[model samples]
Target: MGRYRETYERWKASPEAFWAEAAREIDWSKPWDRVLTLEGDLSRWFEGATCNTCWNALDRHVEGGRGEQLALIHDSAMTGKVKRFTYRELRDKVATFAGVLQRHGIGKGDRVILYMPMVPQAVVAMLACARLGAIHSVVFGGFAAKELATRIDDARPKLIVSASCGLEPGRAIAYKPLLDQAIELSEHKPEACIIVQRAELEAPLVPGRDFDWKDEMEKARAAGAAPACVPVAATDPLYVLYTSGTTGKPKGVVRDNGGHMVALKWSMKNVYGVDPGDVFWAASDVGWVVGHSYIVYGPLLHGCTTILFEGKPVGTPDAGTYWRVIADHGVKALFTAPTAFRAIKKEDPAAELVKKYDLSKFELLFLAGERGDPDTIQWAERALGVPVIDHWWQTESGWPMVANPMGLERLPVKYGSPTVAMPGYEIQVVDEAAKPVPANTTGAIVVKLPLPPGCLPTLWHNDEGFRNSYLADYPGYYKTADAGYLDEDGYLYVMSRTDDIINVAGHRLSTGGMEEVLAGHPDVAECAVIGVADALKGQVPVGFLVVNKGVNRPAEEIAKEAVALVRDKIGPVAAFKTALVVQRLPKTRSGKILRGTMRKIADGEAWSMPATIDDPVILEEIGEALSDAGYGRKG
Candidate 1:
């Protein structure tokens, strides 16, 4: 809190000064002629500065005698194996992997798709691309064959890497088999499909198409090339991260090489308060941008000890597994989703034994996946004896926009507000006409000007798509489809997506708020709310809940209980019309509940899924539940 308090005051007092100070951390080929010059839509930061971010991240730090320091702490739950690497060790590993890529004909600007899980080899592949100046696109490990094929078609990488399957919590989804299926469909099968054997639960590697990962690594070591950092421009494409396909097929958000590095490093330091020697863990799959930015880029660039686990936070081992790992590792600062937090908090709090370890070493607890409810924030504070700092950002933003800046914005355990925009960001809540809405009024959230380092330059292979998605709807600003407001204190309180907001009897409601309340129920495992159209009023909220195993009750009874909880917690205006209890919520491949899809089902419309959802069958069950509840029954 002390660090964050100082940063918040300093940044708020003079943002330009705050950002200028942070910019000095970047390895600039030449100092900026101006820190930033804003004229029209062109807001250039550190104009004239040039340098490869890879140099700063991998080379410069090691060259200066941090070589032997631990850089990554990678583990695989499926295999019960762990690999620890130092900066010096990684320097060589990256070289070896880069050499293997060269042997496979991967080179500068060549797209390489990595569809592997959060194993050490995955990070090796990422750094290998950095070493060779190749563009790497990481498909989330959970993606099905069709989704994998879609991204493969879009990127057309020279090489693809995967294990036979992906393991999360209780199940192992066969990744190599899925990749094989994708390759069968793809006209352009990557020239070489590399296989890594992580979970020995799978069969032996395919003979011709697959090579043993250890053998490949050994071969690269036998024929070594001097590891050279890729000479990339600040504007060069660093990564192409696909967002959760909310509107249509997933759009690849292209983040620039240097800018992304700069933004991530700064945000990790200032926003998340990541510190050297700290064990950082963000429990998100590699497919989503948060997973890419926090789980991989920012923490690695900052040289923090990052934990990359290949299984679910709550896997077959149970919900207590995460807390046990935290206790075992003595992790100082942990970043995770509010959805996960709510679930973990529901578990026998007595079983979440932070006291088993000396948890006093920890100071920061970060939450994302919608601004957490106040109860969640307070609950975390009480349970962890640490403040639960919430954050809000999108795939296009590259890094966090509104965050409880570490060494800066520390607040009491209140929910809803993410935080004020960090230094160099111009955030506003505007009405439909693009006029700035009055403070405390919910409106369209937008970024008014050019941002700090790490913003996505464009969408992968889609210039018009980029313009249409972010810039077209709003004349000049970046429109965050989520509706939110700023209090007089200047802290921004973000809600779920605009479509997720329910206007019940003309009273506005955020689904997050209602879901948070529902989560307090012992029977609920997870829940999603959607606004169904009302003939007279406008829209009323309806909930679809996934009941926890072993907890069975009449839907009507639970529905009545849910309404009372919301009415008491957030007032009567946020009332729900119906609560359809189900076994699972409709979620995308990335685990984001598609409220828009739920909304369609609630409205009795034929469901047309966005491209991201791996499982479309859950919604059918939900619809069945809804129909049984008389959702579509005519009087």
Candidate 2:
């Protein structure tokens, strides 16, 4: 704790100097002339520095005699296969892939789209793009053709990398057809598409435009040609990842090279308490920012073995798989989404699988991607005998903005709080007027400019959109759009997204807070709380709950227990009386609850279906439940 406060104060006093010192840990091609330069909202970090992200992540480690050391441990429960790659092996593959891309005239500064699953080839493809100094725009593999087409039009990529199929728990879903459809629908088409024959589905190649991945790799290897790492400027674009927007369009978040390298390396050591050669696992897809920073770049940059897991928490042969993997690999740290634990808790409440494995090797477990509820945190920490940190960040901020800073010092655990801001990040709770609020008072969360390294510099192709969406919301601060508060101890409690906050009888209430309470109910498996229009109170919370399997209690009785628990825990201000038991809550393919879509259904507003949704039928079921409960809109 003392170390945390000390580092925070030191960073606040001299951020540029602090970051400069941290940057020294990595192998830079050329030293920076200026540590930082700022003009209004725009920032330039490590000015005059030139380096290749691939060189830092791979070549440096291999050149430093760690070539035989394990760099990637790919475990695919979906395919029931495991593969390992050493630093040297991964480098050779990336070099060959880069050569393949170069043969097609794709070079530095060109954009390439990666639409693939959580496979080793996806990792190879991303590293290959970085090796050539090309910017990779990774669209989530589960995205539909229309959504993929939208991103294709925006990026206009020169090349596309995809897989023939993505294996789910019970079925193998073909992806090459989807990619073909997306290419057909988009106005801009790539020069060529490279497809990995994963499931052996017959995917016809369009002459002169489609190429088989294995054939190209073999040819490149036979030719004895390997692409050299192309040096890129510090401020050059490394990747552009899009975020889901309510306006039916996505905002491409751009991350620069140098700052991203430095910040992520620092975070891997200081925030996650991981060192070189350790096994670190972040159970996220390659498309997300967490995957970009931790699973791929950060750990590799720090010379650690990163795991690429392709499995769910409960489905891939029960809840014991994670424990088995940790035990088998001696994984030092595990980072995953809180929703995963919630689902695991529902499937195996006692966590019997935890005792089956020798998890003594695990040092820490991290939770993110959604709000970490108290029940989920306590369950994981107590079961795993490790610190379960509830860190907070978003797509725009590549690394965590608020975390426990485990490498610095382990502090007293606050169940729901994500703890203090990391070095270079100054967070504050402010009211609608953009003025600072008192401690323990909920308000919009904002970070004082300029943001730390690893944060998005701007939205791709839309500078004004970046300013209007994030910067202009509150002058002088980067509006987080999420609502939270700081305690007297400086621990931050992120309650909900500002739009998800409910106003009941003129008092603001956090639906996430209410959902946390509902989660503690004995008969509840999972639940989502959403604010629906109330003619009198402006808005009120309506809960959609999934009752725990094998619970003997009636659905109505379980709902009553949930309401009582919330009423007692949150007091009368919560106004959380109504709840309905549903079979399943609408969720994205990544398992995020679709609260916004639920709110639209409750309010009877015109809604566009999100391509990321797992099941469209769940929305209809919710509507039926709402109508039966008399909260449905009049048709």
lDDT of 2 at 156: 87
Highest-TM-score candidate: 2
lDDT of 2 at 2: 88
Evaluate model 2: give its lDDT.
0.89
TM-score of each: 0.90, 0.98
Per-residue alpha-carbon lDDT of candidate 1 for residues 49-83, written as tens digits (9 for 90 to 100): 66666566667768878888888777666667778
Candidate 2, pairs of clashing residues: none
Query: Where does the lowest 10-residue lDDT sum fall in candidate 1?
Result: 345-354
The CA lDDT of each predicted structure is: 0.73, 0.89
